[model samples]
Target chain A: MTALATGTGGVGSCFISQLTWLSKNLPSTRLSLCYISMIDKALYRPDYAEIDFDTALFTLEATGVEPPPISTIVEYLAAAPHNVILVDNTSAISLAEAYPAFLRRGISIITPNKKAFSGSYQLWQEIFSSATSGGSYFYHESSVGAGLPIISTLKDLVQTGDEITRIEGVFSGTMSHLFNKFAPTSGSGGKWSNIVREAKELGFTEPDPRDDLNGLDVARKLTILGRLAGLPIESPASFPVESLIPAALENVANADEFLRSLSKYDNEMEEKKLAAERSGKVVRFVGSVDMLGKKAKVGLEWVDQTNPIANLKGSDNIISFYTKRYGDMPLSIRGAGAGGPVTAMGVTGDLLKVLCQLR
Target chain B: MTALATGTGGVGSCFISQLTWLSKNLPSTRLSLCYISMIDKALYRPDYAEIDFDTALFTLEATGVEPPPISTIVEYLAAAPHNVILVDNTSAISLAEAYPAFLRRGISIITPNKKAFSGSYQLWQEIFSSATSGGSYFYHESSVGAGLPIISTLKDLVQTGDEITRIEGVFSGTMSHLFNKFAPTSGSGGKWSNIVREAKELGFTEPDPRDDLNGLDVARKLTILGRLAGLPIESPASFPVESLIPAALENVANADEFLRSLSKYDNEMEEKKLAAERSGKVVRFVGSVDMLGKKAKVGLEWVDQTNPIANLKGSDNIISFYTKRYGDMPLSIRGAGAGGPVTAMGVTGDLLKVLCQLR
Candidate 1:
């Protein structure tokens, strides 16, 4: 039995489309989508009847009932006739809090949610230990560098006994897009505030752009990767994260107000960009985990024009793993870091991994 | 039971060290090595006794017997009390030919050996079909990019229902080194022949450097990737490949003779580099499979100076996959594509994958 819980729009809808394709192509697996839900509504049967992936969204919109509590959902899935694999595509904190409870009842999970893994050290310990105690599988490949194989590659390096000395990358697509447009490698770019306003207009940033500028998204990604690379990172707040939001704008009434006033500090950003240009480099926002020093940091840095990070195009994310086996050169992966379809691909990929190991 | 068949030098010894590390850290899995063999000798017991990974190499040197025939070894592994995973680290065509026989007997296989998959299309079909027929597993993540997650990432993108349109890369590390040094992005470089000689002295090229200049290795890798992307590529030789070895020296008696006489034709390569430089581009040897057009080609190409392929350092490889979901920008991976330890890391990573699936 398979369950999908997602928000009504964005990646949730894209995941359902891919699920329809998988069900048709892999009929032998007899994969049945038994339950699906949005934040306020849910669709399922008491007998665990299969739900049609192609019509799941339409059905949920038409005849869905009130959603059950997290505990009730866990009980329903764990009591199914066959094995259960839950696909959590929502970033809801409450749902993330229920992961250990689900795992303790022998329900495997595949998710793209960061909160479940990067929220707190105790929660991280509980999630894995519960999976071990109940012999359940858990995978979150999309928690960092969505759909870029960053998490899995790092896991392989560590599991295969390669000593990873460092891991650094452009972990946030918003930051990447901002920097690439504001400080392109070969050309002078527009002012930083103008770029920020333009990015918001293009729907690249959150409704409240400060959420993206505060560096929490990048920090959450670094926390997930840092722990995976053998560092016991406490949380996203445990390290120094250089926020791009100006101090005066932190308490702005709204995003429009913030964007309107952002130009006042354009000179500061221009100075930083110009300084990097003078040294034959470009400014980029990056997150890094220094394993040897046991430190994780997220911020802006001057990157060589030839470095992969400086050369990143669009909003593509790039992660480089520096390990002993690979010597001086690090293993790196790059691509679109965020998009509804690609983010859902990571969720679907993790689901496939869980399915392969099932029975 | 686990068995390792290696060539006793280079990658074989590195794989042993990695295996030793895995056996210690993952002791809960109880993955015991039961057999080991080089080309000339073998070590094992009738009872499938555990061979200590830490001392297996020394033990084989001290007490080993003449290796048995391939058929006999397959039979012995099939009769073991537990499941078997055979690690093939040699690139011997003969042993690659025996892969189907081993899989048909219910023994899973993991390796970095390219011959097994790239040799013949018929063998490729037989290998997967036999594994399915015998209820066994088979994985070779290192076949395309050593320890870089290239094959796995491509498989994930395809399996999760993403439509792949193109696959392109500088696949060979030797080719990457030669071109990077011969046609640097920023400044004028030395002659192609001089760069080739330097690569050989640095141990970046094969003993006979022509083995790398021939372009067959890159073609083989392209063939494997193309097949995985759902193309029925017949074989590596079925496509066009541009060999760097000049026609006059194609049949040179020895590598030393070829190197001594290579400078005679430097003007031809110089012209190509100069032409590319005029267009603000650099020359790189690249292999590409255009899925939409159903074609795969390997040859020299002009790349933008800022392209990731043009900025590669040392002996590194870069692969880019263009797909429908990713839109105009392709997902790319870059790293050390060939090395003993990294290649062995891929082998060990595949072993871990297979182990997780074992009942």
Candidate 2:
């Protein structure tokens, strides 16, 4: 099978390294990378020859042509004699919206991008339908829980005729760290603002801490999980997501200003923390979906100390899947939910799945 | 693809139900149940027509003929016009030893039986090489940790080029229940003999409680994990496995007789429990594989209360994968590790994977 890839960021670089290892390891499965690209530059041959993975990234950065339009790229891949797989490493919604065009042209996709699946119900429907009509496949395993088997586990449960009653978990590494530091189960933790600031300095949060605080990242993960569970979630914005960004800092001019003003609202978070402690519970930032009620929510919730969500270590993400076959105790997966190699592992694993099918 | 099955016991019955549901839901994939069999009887059409899954078990039990030789069954499956997948749900070592025969004839297999995988190291090598040479696939996700994604998760990490440093977990449901009942974190629990007797009555242990107490079940699971993680483990017996069955009871004639006399040795287990408590730890039955050191062991271990293995609930199994990419924190999975529906879910999930590739 021929492979094409976009993005040269953290996950993208790690994916290239893993793909090189796979090429050397799997003698039976032939993976020919014919196209490699970033946002502005691309590397490919008119005849679609295999590009050497070890040198492709460096050579493309040194001397590459401007990327062509999505339609032209789709047409180029569709004309190949062998099956094609487009590995989308970028989180750009523009590239995600073009998924149907590629899938409709018999080009399969294996991506870690969340936007493609959680963006809109209409696009989700189109992408899936196009894959079926064109006899291609689309998989986004890292969209929700990085390298964790959250998406695949839930999908197997639903596909195998098991009913998923609920899904609850700490879906974000940033929130996992922040809440764990602010309201640890052992005892009262530091003030919320101090924990957030410390997390920011430790590189646990996004470039702007507000990006992690807005609740959209967790909401996007929930949206993906809910959709896979057979819920027609319209968009990430379709549900009621409780944001941690206070109104005072909502319109801050810059991230520095936002961080500085965040302390003023520390009392509000402290009160929520104390209320949970009074009841022998700890507060955690989590996302949950009730399948029977057809509802999904992302926010802070009081969890018992014995609950797996409250017992998470470091910045590890924990997802508990409650299904009919599993009964009361949900099937759960936990680990580092974000990072270059782990996230890239999800894409690489998905590519292997596609390779098996293409064979 | 054509399907053949052996065994119609707990997991086999549930797998058939799931397959029937899959046939109804997956419109694009054609699944024809061409053959069905028990230990002594078989059902297959001369023309290779679809045997309806909804009534396969009933029809097989009522009118099935005596099963022929293993070679005959292999030849029958190999000659099918479509791809053939044989689902083995029996625990018989005799049937497991015949896996190479089927795979050499281009017959794929998806099984929950542990015998084929955790058997002799030479047999493991033969089974894998046959699958490669004959262009067939083999998957057994439920052989260890039921349907908790334990096998698949370890596989993905290794295949994606991650270095697995260690593997530690409670791999048996009976053991998990036993230790959690005897040395629970909250307080001192019941006597060891009483817990075992109660668990057997609850049907959590095997027909003979000694079958689970022997610790070989957990050792078998560890053998599978160590092999997958690149260790050349010879066999489960090659490594030290601390069996809990007493010397006198080891030769007991019956389960009832063993259970009645088990109380006489309660002090031996109580000593271990008290030792763990002295160190502020809990004693749990566990298996560990040290990859670099090339060591694998199964027995009781003192675990910190904060450890995921110690914190496991009910009969839930917890597997922690210590890998290079994952760094200090290991990728972990926990859930109900034993049950008919969940175990069959793993088999059904592997079948879907085969279907995708066969497409």
Candidate 3:
């Protein structure tokens, strides 16, 4: 099968690199690039220098292709003799809206986009029904957790008589970083602020760290997870996000300013850490959805040291699905929750899953 | 899809129970018992009494027209209008020999039997070729690590850019039981006799505990794993079997006699355990295949307590596949290595995977 993949950012570059390598290695599958779009093309020229394959077949544009204006790409797909699978590596909101069109053309969409499912319940139902009716698959294994295979595991468990009662996890790399860096552990008061700065420098956090520090990114992931567990979840905005930045620091102009302002809140967090340590507990930012009692709001919780999430280090995201069959000890999945390579691998895995399902 | 499953003893009974319950609750798939063979039919009858499913189609005879022989089973499959995927849950080694014949008749085989792949390299090659030639699949995901999905993960990792350098794990549940129960703990002498007896009584170990304790069971699993990682491995018998029991214990006439003679070697193991602890390590009966210097040997390794396998508890097995792409921390798969239910679920998962591939 010939693939025409787009996007040229971090995820985009990783996908293209994998596809290019797979094209040479996998004899059965053939991949070809149809388009490459990014804010800057000069930066990626060195990365594409080794490619001996045809580049003229696709154009490298400066801006991303508009979702509604993908008719030309769709035409290229329809013209091909072999079946084509459309991979959406773009923003979630855009991909979600464009998914139905691809499904109409018998093109499967495998994405890391969390938006479509985490959107309104109507959109979620529409995407699923359209994909099923069109004899195609919509796979987003990378949406909730990166490269851990949580969705597939859950699917297998549910299909084989295991009933999941609660789905809980440290669903964010950003939050994991915050706790790992800031938590009191024989470190100075200013150590937390310095680590956050280093994280931003390493490109681990968003350009504006507020998107991560405010807990919006984690909330989106939790929303996606709840839907996968058969819950019609509310939007991420609806979840009560406990901000790491104090109200005084919220008005910072940028990441550097934000980091400088976060120092004031460190003492307050240290006190909480001390209290938790005295009680023989470690703090972890956790997201949980409990179905055993009355259907409740799925949101983040502060887990104790005894909890699996509390033990998670670095950027590791750990998920524990408590089920009737599994009893007290839930089926746990732990691994690198966020990274360019790992997240891209998650997307790649989801793409393969769709390809495997295609007849 | 409607499935007509045959047989109901040992692992077959577990599969039937799982399939029956899943089909009823989740009505996405329907299961019908086409045939059932049992030494004592009373066990299954009373257990299934409360379930109001039709049993008129089922048969009771152990070896009769009810459950047809291999040839007749293939014929029934060829004549059936709906696409039938043959799942062989029997221990008949001849089923491996007949796999090619079934594939030629357009029937896919999903079996937990290891005989086909582990018998001979040439025969294993022929079986694989025949399946591909006949445009069918022969998936045995449960053949290696029960419900752990080790084979599938290895396949995926190898399919990507990962070059497996070493494959290590506790591949035998019976061995895990022996090690956990008998391997000397803090200040206690090893209870070798009691561990062996308890393992047999609980059905965790094979009828012959020697097969597990002597490392033959682990060798078979490691051989399968080596093959999956693209290694041309020798048969299980070729690997050196390190017996936990002394030479004198091997000549014992009965289980009681063997138990009586186990105390002599208890002191030796206790000393070894203490020595390992002093060196900042734990003694785990580990099976590993390392290809560091153009030579590979599947043998025992004493891993440190910090290692994943060393921390494995109970019958839980943890596998680590070290590869170039994965770096130092290889992809780790940990779960219940042995159990009728988990093993049966592995077969069920393979069935679903094959179905997905077919679609």
Candidate 4:
């Protein structure tokens, strides 16, 4: 089963296109879209009929009914003829809370949604434990670093008995873009406030720039990775996350008002950038987990000019896994961390993995 | 079943240690060693029995008899009660040639051995086809880039219906070490002859350094990757590979004599380094596959001062995958790429993957 929105350029819509390609290319896979939904409407059959992957979006939009409650959907999936995989494309916390319900019903899950994994630690424990009891699988590779192989690589390293001492990287595409432009390695980049304004105009930032600046996105990623590395992180708020929003403007009534006053802090950011430059370094917003120290942090750091973090280009996310096997130098993976097609690729890849193991 | 030779400083020995660790940590995986062997000696029971992973090496040396022929071993593995996974630790072409025989009988294979995959195209085709016919699995992630996720990542990208346009990297760790010391990014590095001699003394090169200088290692890696990327590469020899070994020393009978005469080409290498320096670049030996153009090559290239390839440190390997989805920037994985622990880690990682799919 899969869910996608009808709007143009939506990740849900883009994911459906990739699923269509996958269904056509992998003929051996018995792919069937038995359920699909949006927030308000859904398209599914009482008889558990396979929805046409090619016209799923159009079909849902044309003739959809009110989405059933979580319990009803779980019951419907639990009674399917074959194994079922739930593709959660939306970032709905309510849907995320229903993950254990689906997994307990012997339904697997493949998703890019972070809330299911990065939410409260209690939910995290419940999800994995439920999957174990129900003999179901759950994969969320895109939750932390979008389409990059961060999650899988870490799992491999840990599984192979390699000790991961640390994991640090640029986890947020928005922060990566803002910092790369505001204090670039090659040149003195644009003013901080102007860069924020430009990034918002470019659609790189969240609808409200403060949403990205508050550092919750990066902290949430760190929280998920820390837990995966064997640390029972209570939540994203359990660690120290340096928010970029000034204390003075924490309660700005609107984004326009926030932007109007953001320039006032340009001198403060310029000072940090110049200080890093004076030390022959560049500034980058980064998140790191010291596994041995049992600590995770997200904030600005003065990275060396030649460091990979400083050399990031075009808002790419770079993660370095410092492990026992890959000694001295960490095993690093770098690329576009967010987007419709690539992120969808991660979900699709996980779905294939779950398919291979299903009876 | 598992097998490892008994010796100090042997990859087989290290692999057993890792396998022992894995068995202890991952209790769900029912790993057992039914056979153990060295080049001349082997140990096995008439009835397949689990050999203790911790003591397999010692037991093999203490009680092993003459190793049976390849066909006999295939029959032994095929007759096992449960599924069998053959981990080929040695880079023996004879063992590689028997892959089809084993796969044709439903025995999975996991290895860092490059010979089986990079050999004659016919053998590659036979191996894969035989695996398909017998319903067995084969994974050789360590064939290139050790345990740096090169093979798995490429497989993910291709499997997800992404278009791979190009693949380029410094593949051979020995070559990476020699070239980095010969033409460092930040300094006028040591003379090429001295660097090669130093690398040999440091145990970074093959017994006969010429084996590494012949450029065949990188070519073999490129062949495997190119074939995976959907090119019908005939063999490693089907493309241009510039050997770094000078013509005068090509026929040297021993490594000692070759080392004594290698100084004659120092000026030649120095000139090449100077040429690159004139353009404000550094020289590094690299392998590249133009997936779109259907070509593969291995040789030296002038890399930019700030390029990741130029900045590579130690004997690390770096691979960059340029694809349609990941536009402008390529997805790159970098790490140690060589060494017994990391390479064994790859084999172990592949074993876990096979374990997941086994009945």
Candidate 5:
């Protein structure tokens, strides 16, 4: 199978490493690196040569050509002698939109990009239909909870005719970290502003912390899950998403200005925390897709001390599927939801599954 | 593709129901149940023909012929024109021993039978090698944790080149229930004898509750996991297992006699629970595979309140995977580990994955 990779950032770099490992271990399947791209630059040959795993990135940086248009890349991959898998790790809206174009030409996709799945519902439909029409496949396990097995498990439940009544969890590692330190279940937590800043310094938050605080990331995840649960979710914006960005800072010129003014709103978050504590609960930034109710939401909720959601540690994500088959106690999965190696593991895992079918 | 099934017990009956639902919904895959069998009776046709899932169990009990030997069954399946998936939901040691024979004939197997996987190391190796040699497939997701994603998750971690350091969990639903009631983290619990009795009545334990108390069930689960994590686990008996069955009760005639004599050992368990309570911890039956140390064991452990194992509720099973990529926080999965519906869901889920390969 021919392989194409996009982006050379955190997850992309880790995926390349894992792909290298997989290529070595999987002797039955030969995965040749036929094409690779990073924003403006790309590396490929008309003959689809295998790239050296150790020096591919450095060589691409040194001697790569300017990347062609999305359609051109699709044409190249579609014409490959063997089946192709396009691994997209970047958060580029343009690239996410081009999924249908590539998939329609028989280029399978394995991605961690949430935008392709959680964007407008039309795009979601188109991507899948294109894969079907083209006799290709796509999997986005890392799109939701990174490497937490959330997507695959949900798919199994739904595919096996299990009625998923409710789906709930923390969907963002940054939000999980912020709220965990801000309103801990046991100890008295620090101020919300300080917690967010600490998460940023530790690289848990996006480059612009507001991007994490806006609740869009969590909303996007809920959209993907809600749709998978049989809800025709129009888009992430169609439902209520309680953004953490204070009104005054919502239009801040930059992340620095937003961070500097975030402390002024600490009193607001503190009040919510204290209110929850008075009722013997902790406030957590959580997302839920009510399949029975046909609703989806992402925001803060008062979680009981005994609830698994309240006891979550670090930046771990916990997802619970309340299916009819599973009964009262939901099937829950928890772990470090996001990381270079872990997210890449999800992509690699999906690749392995795809290889089984395509091989 | 053609399908065959064995066993018509709890999981088997439930599997038929799910398979019925799946066949109606999966328009692309025509899964024809060519044959099905229980221990005493069998149903099939010389030429592979689809059986009605709704009436299969009832029909088998009414007019089924006596089951042929394992080799004969394999020979019949191997002669079938189409690819075959053999769904074995039985605990028959004889059937477990025949996995290699079936796989070597290009007959794929999807099962929840722990005996097939956690048996002798040679059998484990043989089953896999036979699958490769015959170009067949097999998956045993329900072996460890019912419908939980334990096996699939571990495979992803290992296959993606993540170094798994340790795996620790409460593997048995019966044990989880017994300990959660007898030594709950935040509650004053009942006597071990009474807890065991309650669990038995609640359908949490095997018919012979002593079967659960013997700890071999948990040992078998640990063996499967240990081997998957790259250990050459000789067998479940190769590890040190702490059985809950008292020395005197070990020779009890039946479940009733065992339960009547169980109260005699209440003090033994009380002491262990008290010892844990003295340290502000709870004692729970648990299993662990230390990959780096190359050791595996199953026994009772004093767990701190913060540990997920201590706070487990009902019959939920929790597994934590500590891997090099995941770092300090282990990837953990928790939920209903056993039940007719859930266990069958695992088998059905595995069948779906195997279908992807075999189709």
Candidate 6:
């Protein structure tokens, strides 16, 4: 069965490449063509179109092209003969209203998109119910911890009588990177700025690292996780986001400029690191949803050096679900949380899960 | 969906208890009755018969029942109102002949029985083909590694374009126990009699630990692994059996008497352990199936402390499947390889997998 996948930027290109690889490896599944670069095509350059295939290319007639609309895309999907799967990897800002239409038509949706799950609670419930009723599935396994199988594992645990009471973890790849680079004893001076710049060069951070350094990405992930675990989670904006970027660097022109301006905040951060080291603690950006307070927040927490999260290296994400079945010792899952191949694999894993369900 | 599980001795009772628990937890899937204790009907036992409402009960007429002459059980199964999923948790002596008849009847078999897979190669092929043609399945996930999902993982990898080249691991829990106790620094006196006695006392060894210490159990597991990985394997008896018990001890009347006479072999084992330790290695009873050689074997091998198998603690079993996709980094799976709950859970897991496929 052929699938149509959208978006081809950053993680989006990785998703496209993974689908291409899956198509070749799993002959039973294929990706025919993609709908991408319809809006501000110059802003997004994809490497997928270089391959020899009949791609339904679209671009803005002017500077702002809407690319028909979601309903039009749904209509195109309805007319297609072989395509049975719809993968939306876009950040079109209109997908929040478009997903339900695809679900109603029994077309499975496998996405890393956080919008649908973290949107209005009623709409999320409607989409969930509609997908289930239509004999199709809606999987956002990659929305939580990338490639960790967190959502699937949680579903299995709940189905098998595990009661999850508290959820705590370092959910941000950007924050994880920042802490790993800046919290070490040798993390002083201009080296911090160079490390942040290197992270951007490697595509570890967003086009604007502010989206990550400000904790919004982590907040969005935690919101989706909360909803998947059966909580009525609110918007990501409601969570208190402590920005690592100082006020002076907030208005920087681009990522390079922002990195250059971040040098001023290094001393403040280094002082905190020194104090933490003296007390045998490591600074980690932690997001938690606790049942005791029935709340969720993302903040800098001083974890003891002996704790699992404190010693986590690079962009690895670790989660501990404290449940009744598991008792005092929580069920812990740890893995590399951010990378092209890993995140792409997470999306691919979700695709496989959908295929298994549909088959 | 109730099943009438027969043979309730050793691991059989554990299966019966698991079925009962699954029935209670999943009320939609109830186990009607189980055949138990034909040898001593008057002995005090757990009440597995409590759930027998509209379900019929059949009693085995003989002690040490050897699968009821095939035709008799087939006839009994065919006449039963409910569809039966036969679970054979018996010894090799019984299962070697019983599996073919059930396969022809389209009855699903979820077994921990090692015999059928470790039997003649032709018989294994026939049973598998018959099950396929009859529109049923013969799942023996628990056969090789108890609760570790080794077969399921291998099947998944194979289905996803992974070519498995080499398979190795500690395949016997009883042997693991023996090695751990007799490894010189274990402080269990490093005596063969003490180790064997302690293994039995700790419930790691079977009622007759001869099959384990003689390496036959590990050989059987390796044969099964070889078959599952698509290798044409010979019978378990084809592998050389290295007996730790001397000829004089082997002639002992019973297991207790054999344990009482094992002191003679202590010095020999201690010397070997010391030599291994000095060479920066730990002794493990390793089972390996080499694709290049097209053979399977179980033997004592010295592995460095850094190896995954060397770090295995207690009754932990570890498997490394070297495949084309996974390359030099073998897919390692580790967990409890023995125990009533873990083995029962493995059977339960296989049942759930069947249910998932059916759905």
- List interface RMSDs for the candidates, in order: 0.8, 0.8, 2.8, 0.8, 0.6, 5.2
Model 5, runs deviating above 4 Å? none
The TM-score values for the models, in the order shown, are 0.98, 0.98, 0.86, 0.97, 0.99, 0.70
- Measured by DockQ, the strongest candidate is 5
- Candidate 4's TM-score reads 0.97
How well does model 3 score by local distance difference test?
Answer: 0.65
Docking class of 5: high
User: Each candidate's lDDT (Cα)?
Assistant: 0.89, 0.89, 0.65, 0.87, 0.90, 0.66
Report residue A27 deviation for candidate 5 (angstroms).
2.2
Scored against the true structure, residue B3 in model 2 reaches a CA lDDT of: 62
TM-score of predicted model 6? 0.70
Candidate 2 chain A, which ten residues in sequence have the lowest lDDT sum?
A1-10
Q: Model 2 segments beyond 4 Å from truth?
A: none
lDDT of 5 by residue, B1-359 (tens): 65665578889999998988988898566787878888889998887777888899888889899998989899999998888888998889999999999999999999999998998999999999999899999999999899999999999999989999999999998899898899877768998888888888988889999889899999999999999999999999998999888898889789999999989888888999999999999999999999999999999999998899998898999999999999989999999999999999999999899888877
Per residue, candidate 2 scores C-alpha lDDT tens digits across A102-127 of 99988999899999888889999999
Q: Model 1: per-residue lDDT, tens digit, B42-136?
A: 88899888887778888888898998888998988888888888888887788899999999989999888899899889999999999999888
lDDT of 6 by residue, B1-359 (tens): 54454444556656655565566676755455533333333111134343342222133332224334456666666555655566666664564567777777776677787888888988898888888776666788778777555776566545444467999998887776677656623343366668788888887787877757788888888888887788877688876656666777777889887877677777777787778888978777888988767877778789865565665556667777776644455545555676655565566666665555445
Residues A254-298 of candidate 6 have per-residue lDDT tens digits of: 877888787777677777777887887877789888765678888
CAPRI grade, predicted model 2: high
Clashing pairs in 3: A282-A305
For model 4, name the residue pairs that clash.
none
lDDT of 5 by residue, A274-335 (tens): 99999999999999988888989889999999898988888999999999999999999999
What level of docking quality does candidate 6 show?
incorrect
Candidate 2 at residue A325, lDDT? 95
